[model samples]
Target: MPESDPLQPGSPESDALFELEPRAAETVGFAQLARLPLTELVAPDWAEALAPVEDALREVLAFLAAEAADGHEVLPPPSYLLRAFRQPLAGVRVLIVGQDPYPTPGHAVGLSFAVDGRTRPIPRSLANIYKELDADLGLAPRIHGDLGRWAEQGVLLLNRVMSVRSGAARSHRNRGWEAITAAAISAVADRRTADGGPTPFVAILWGRDAWSVRALLGTAPVIASAHPSPLSASRGFFGSRPFSQANALLQAQGNGTVDWELPPLP
Candidate 1:
């Protein structure tokens, strides 16, 4: 008995290779292919092509689930795993990284976060930052209206640690999330433009821990700043509005501004 060659046409290994019987080259149609298992119909290279992305996503989800099961709580349920994965990973022009998810449930909707204000009602530090940005860019109350405008300009708002604790307890502190953050930074660094050119993306680090991860970003240039918490803001967090400054830098670099306004502070 000897090991059989998998490439051989009539070998048992060949059956595994071609899970679906070859269509007689006449009856192949979209309906027939749609009914077949993806693994059977797709070329071997197809799986190979997606292997890296699939593997990275699995690693991220597994890490998050394990952290949660280990008593480390995240704001949105692990169910939001799909939504997080659905987010655009690469080619984003501006990247904003915060510390962790807000302790409030249903608040970490992946794309939106609480900012102290009449419109959004976020934390104090966020209010201060917005106020400073409003003055610097001449936008005050309008900043509260539509924060999603940043996303339209290719700004990706993400947290270094996607999980947070709730209520009067700090029991949901993240212990092993730094690794996932590092992985995400790596993924974004490797992302390319649709036309095969290098994507010149800018990253904003809002908190101390978030800013500390700059070493993990490799070649990505990061604009570091104090955390946007009441304590940090009081200590001059908004002294230099990093978001507006980054945009100004982008403008100077030939990337013109979009239809955005930095409203006046209330």
Candidate 2:
């Protein structure tokens, strides 16, 4: 798929994509074409990689729209639905896959295991991730929970389920979000860097849910561990050293490492 022009000022493409489908179809199926207009929901940088899964993505959005119409609160808001994809994957060297968005209000900021900078007492899983970062890389812990620094430095924080109903964990599972995210993972693995070298990205899969997509990664390196939730951190998540291992994997691919020393958001 060739890239479309960048959306101009006050373009209606954004609004049209988010609007609920006014279709009269009886059954929801993968092959069902979406009536929604997608002007540029995905950045042009990802057009080729994501084109195959676009249909499934639209269906998942339809399910989300229906949920919202039924008064179900969605987490992280719509503006952040594609937040993780804002950066081009060509520069992305690390892929960190999480199960789903945080169900609590104001917690999930579209990136997996990340939240608003001002979110107090960050989610336990994020706290444990901070602890592991310190242990693995000797980086001191900061007061904020935002992971934008890592994202900017080529780490992709993507969740298996892009959206979830507020206050209801895994409420949006079994929807079409999985197929969409699976395609994203495949894009990362199949991506060839500048000069046409082999793909340079590595994947850090957390928990069984995140690990489920491992088969999609053709030859990309992977680091897997139990989820960082309190219940399972003690089992294998605590001392897994995923951060340092991920950095090593990236370096092996001749890519620069992520700056794990994230400062408190200003």
Reference-based TM-score of each model: 0.62, 0.85
> Which lDDT tens digits does candidate 1 get at residues 88-182?
45425767776665566444544434332244555455567667666667665444423445655666666666555544233334554455556
Instruction: Report model 1's TM-score to 2 decimal places.
Output: 0.62
Summed backbone clashes in each candidate are 14, 0
Give stretches of model 2 more than 4 Å off: 1-39, 194-197
Question: Each model's C-alpha lDDT?
Answer: 0.51, 0.76
- Candidate 2, residues 51-162, lDDT tens digits: the string is 8887777778767766765777777666566678867878788899998999998787778999878789888999999889889988887778888888888789999998
Error of 2 at 129 (Å): 0.3
What is model 1's C-alpha RMSD? 13.0
